[model samples]
Target: MGTSNKPPKLLRMEDYPSWADKFETYVQALNYETWTAVEEEYIIPNNENGSNYRLSQIVEGDKDQFLREKKMLNLFQQAIKVENFQLLQHNGSCYSIWQALLNKDRGNPDMRKSKMSLLKKEFDIFTQVKGETFAQLVERYCHLVNEMKRLGIDKPDYEYIDKLANARPEEWGTFIMFQQSNPVAYARLNLARFIEKLEAHELELRKNHNMKSTAVP
Candidate 1:
């Protein structure tokens, strides 16, 4: 049988704070002494092969290099603080605007104008959609209107279901109820099935209308 050697123990750096501090102090002291010795040894020009560069040259070069590095470090630290402050200020401004838009009291005119402008832009975009039936328009408008209501935006006096029925009487009864009651669930699960049914109904209507037109001819 072969004998196996045990693995060496591993110590974590975090587990020896006091020892690490003491070790660092001892190392710094040794480094200073060794650096002095190297300086003294290099003063006499002995023609050793690779030991041509003296400690004095390295230290003198490193002084300027260290100062440049420190300046760069300080610049980055200040930049980080400024960036954080700007982010906080922007966040606060957005929050204030949102609160003002949702407020019921007749407050700032600028806030009211901003809110109205946003609403008008949204409405105009919806109104401009080509190839969308009146029913589609009603659905889109109802959803936006409902969302605004949920967010404490001012509600219109007219009923959404009534508007939907006026737009497309054929689909309004079923579609409006489902949209109003369960908008999320209707969108996620029921829209495809509802559209399929609407297509079938339209097909049937088209067939019946064609038959009537032929009979009249």
Candidate 2:
């Protein structure tokens, strides 16, 4: 009976930790020592002349080199983002994904400034984008605020709340006015609490409106 000749499975994209837990196991299984070992026995190939070399002696040197390169390539591939895979796939260096992400984030000053400017514009015009739920809007708002803070543009908590209240629909005016009236309580409400209260108020208003509209004319 003929033996199966199936090649061993190569590390795949799924081996990355961003998606799964296989990368550590895979790395642990890759034995650098075994890869670098020399063979103890000599093999004579057919049609060879006087010189005979050990198969281990010939393959061991290349095996270490091959495994080292494979390990580096696998790490590099794992570090690359799926979105940037096409752009950076051709780059086969040994840099990690965190390094790549850092380099991208710490781009030239002009690029950083440009990104900051765009973020500021988005923040200035920031409202609940159409079809965005309250939670989604809060997430987007907080993201912009955090990004601006990272760029050293942090403002006061009240200022952020003021901006958020301004961005909210007119239906939120009652809550905004109530906040304005109760300065002490309002001051105690952090961004999260503020958003939660406003969202609850909006929901209550919606429920009341729905109930009224459904009543007899």
lDDT of 2 by residue, 1-217 (tens): 1113211232333323222223323443554332221112112232365453433544665554444544545553554445555533223333333234344454568987887888888878888777888778787788788778766777778878888999887867877897889888878777778878877887898899899999959
C-alpha positional error of residue 55 in candidate 1 after TM-score superposition, expressed in Å: 44
Backbone clashes (count) for model 2: 0
Candidate 2, position 216, lDDT: 50
RMSD (Å) per prediction: 24.3, 11.8
Candidate 2 segments whose C-alpha is farther than 4 A from its true place: 1-76, 79-97, 128-136, 150-152
- Give the top-scoring candidate (lDDT): 2
Name the lDDT of candidate 1.
0.41
**What is the overall TM-score of model 2 with all chains considered together?**
0.54
Model 1 Cα lDDT, one tens digit per residue, 95-207 = 23223222422236786667666765664444425578645764677666644554356634333333333444443456546554765654454333544545565577679
Looking at candidate 1, what is the lDDT of residue 118?
76
